[model samples]
Target: MKARSKSKSKSSILFILCVIAIFSLAFTGFKGFKIAGWEIKSIGEAITKGLDLQGGVSVLMEIQEDDVPSDVRQRTKQLLELRVNKIGVSETVVTEEGEKRIRVDIPGAYNSSEIVDGLSKTGNLEFKDSEGNIVLTGKDVKEATAVLDSTSSPVVSLELNEEGQTKFAEATANNIGKTISISMDDEVVSQPVVQNAITDGKAVINGMSSMEEATKLSGIISSGALPVTVKAVSVKNVGAQLGAEALPNAVKAGVIGISLVFIFMILYYRLPGLFASIALTLYITLVLIVFVEMKAALTLPGIAAFLLTIGMAVDANVLIFERIREELSIGIPIKSAIKKGFENAMSSIVDSNSTTFIAALILYFMGSGAVKGFAVTLMIGIILSLFTALIVTKILINLAVDMGLLKSLGQFRVKRGAENA
Candidate 1:
């Protein structure tokens, strides 16, 4: 029965070993593969890279008029961030530069004109009566589409929401046979006479000179408008060559750093150290998978946070191992020592990592751009570190002890006096 128990333990350990090997290769190995007609991309290729890592477009914009209110500027910044992100550029950084300037960095985007057009145009669609009083704004529009009229001419059709429908019904009813001006950013695009109240919440602007004009108007109307007028002051295209060089260097440094940690763990704690290293490997794989699946943008600061967390992870394991050593010194049996070690270390690990987790949350919420990137990575690392130390390392160490692979306290480098105890 004892032999059978040892055999079972050994098989479990072997299974763990296979998991480590397979996960390492599958996630960090060469590119990725296809399964059931779906291509699974490697973490390197699949993860979203930030502007500093992938390089793209940077545009500096400023309010066209002086003395813009803070709330207006803030609303403009928020709107720009949403607008660019909607265009499918992930991890775009839109930050306030100075009192008057705003900087936007979009990774993997190259079209300067499109970027400028999407951002600089206030797109504030307004309707006014012949006397020039504002009647409706872009906020009233539910949908905008570029379509052809019965005459087969390009036009923009607008659909108003419920509130807009009632408002428009009143406006048209009062202004029959009077011209209503449709303007974008105070530039009049069309003036159509309202012949009747005929408001089914739908209206069309007829004066689009071309299909492109109609399409552009429709898109801007649907995307919402900037609260303030802004113009691009400077536009620069970022090249990926620096990012191309930087990524490999960062990866190499991480590899070297982690490799050194593995060596130290193995040399110091012996069997437990070996098991800790495996747990560390699993920690990294799981973290990267989280990042990829979350579509989190990884930047230079994020990578630094990642490396910092690795040290934290090792620190956790070290604490647990020392506790185990202390337990063994008191003459506890191997399995009981391993279990007590973790139980004793649990409070310290949680206490230490929990503070860091709170700090990460604060930074993530209050900070922006790269600061946010760092906070996100740090937060992920702290959670994973705790998990690996409390659960993964404990399981592996207990398994080794049960399999009789760890036979003496000396394997954990406990003092020679305890080796015989």
Candidate 2:
């Protein structure tokens, strides 16, 4: 029993720890579970999808402002979708209506009129001169967009007309240390310093709260370049006062499904069952984290897709563990069995998931609304499952056994007729 060199054990443990960290940071402790002070997670956070599951209200909005162009309404609709999200419930759906109208669906919410009012008004984009003079206005500016610089600080950039550019350069050079006020729909957006003379028809507006804000301003500025006046012509004044009751049921179903899956895996697999259960738990945590981090909508169909992904993840584990048991029963040592089992079964795991992932891809492009939601979750689940089953679960079990965590060959339960035994 010569002691394993510290480096040998250290590297093995590190790889296992890497697998754990990916999921732990991903899941965020299932709301913060800890293992010896480190939070337990599995992958990057799983983003939640919207209903198609939770059920939300859909409202149609019409644009009537004479100032707005028909084509620009679509652009305005996209921008409004971003802005209305600030109220922050969960998932909000905004889509274009026939030319002069738009539709919005706020999940688990029937009341969003106030939000509608705020987004209905066209954004006001302006540029002030060295001495607060109205210089290049949004009308003269062609476009504005957020771009990351080498430093990665979010910058909102503007391009102006030749006439506007000349005026801008002159304003900037003369107004050094002065502020250029920017406003949208009469609301002040930014008052950044005139850092230098801009003779290149381009300007960077500094000073903003967040990248999110910068993105919004860029949209607003462009909204002004191509003005679109949208007024709510029709309001579906409905309240999901009824949906509040359904939210709890969605949660219950998710909990029950996961619990049953865990029990089944453990009952069939023995010690390896416990290992697979742990990995499956990690799988779920990551999926939810991705949802919250990405602001994905948690719809009912999306939840079903999530559960299906979980089962697939378990199947991958079962396949690999079964392969390992087969190897060990043939008189191979524990170390060789683990490695060979994983290596040989890798092909099968890949073949099965690849086809499923491609199907999800097709569904995502062809489907609309709820179908899209289901497609997205299925795609995400397949990717995460592959990582967990092929990499994370195998790494965990191998590390446990390598670190002398398993006491004997019996721990894996390899036997004759093991297929039915």
Candidate 3:
């Protein structure tokens, strides 16, 4: 029994340490390591931040009078999604707020005027014939990207699917010397003379006489044309300078919050408390790792969600510790009490965590902007709390007992009444 216990202790401690190290190294993107190829890039590095934390333009748009029915609004939402995707605004949020309004929130900073310029009008992607007849729509395009020639001439490179490709190739080929106009809504963007057959369903709008023009073209190509011009009724453009100012304060606040929880766990719970603390540290480290791995946006509001998770993690420890106290007061042996306490408290923990998780799910589905960020972090935090409280904390205690490493579980006494149970 003693030999098995020792081995189990070693294994448990080793697992915790390994989890921490692996997560740390992954987050660092192997910056200090010389491993295999792709050392500088990892799945963890791909996590993006939201506009509030990173600073970007937020433009609120209002719907206007239209002949289209309510069902058309649903179709409009899908097209808007396609348009946003085209622009490579990977962190963009576009959703219908009501029957007469839509909300679009995009992350990261932009040249204020440029974004406003692009957004000022409805995005309407259309390919016209020589006589200006509509030949293809945004749905026809398979993919789009920003491409540059050896001469550094930037263009919006596009590819169409089979049927659309055939139509596009024919359109460009037949209009050889004449102009094929590309327009958004009724505004003309490019009137390029067809230079060749473009049989591959590939072509460029030549009027992008400058890099800015090409970039806008790229954005438009990547983000399909908006179905309607969304007027910016309310606009706020946060500068990068503001982000620099706020980051340090945010970091300090987070440090303080986590530190308080860490210290309180160690001071109150005794032997189990120490184990909980270690698990807590690992819990936090893994939360960040999960954030990076999942590419969850870290926004200012997202930070609040993370902090709330810290509290939840602490709460799990509190419950378990209280349960252990209850068993102790009832005259159970320390070893038996530990096991019984964990087993008894588990149902309550599960119930509490599950309810919170459901709330997160609802918030994520129904809320947009910062609320979504908060919801995601809350869900992730609740999950991590459950793991640390049940599996991690229990493992640490069992390992210590098996090692016969500690003199007593007596030192875990705080003068708090047994009623804390």
Best by TM-score: 3
Candidate order by lDDT, decreasing, is 1, 3, 2
Residues 152-199, model 3: lDDT tens digits: 777677788888889988787778898778876677877777777777
Badly placed stretches (over 4 Å) of model 3 are: 1-46, 62-102, 120-182, 190-204, 221-229, 406-409, 414-421
Higher-ranked by TM-score: 1 or 2: 1
Candidate 2 residues lying further than 4 Å off, grouped into runs, are 5-28, 32-56, 60-76, 82-91, 95-103, 107-239, 407-409, 416-421
Mind sharing the TM-score for model 2? 0.60
Winner on lDDT (2 vs 3): 3
Write the candidate numbers in order of decreasing TM-score. Answer: 3, 1, 2
Q: What would the TM-scores of all predictions be? A: 0.74, 0.60, 0.77
RMSD of each: 5.1, 10.7, 5.0
* Global CA lDDT computed for model 1: 0.84
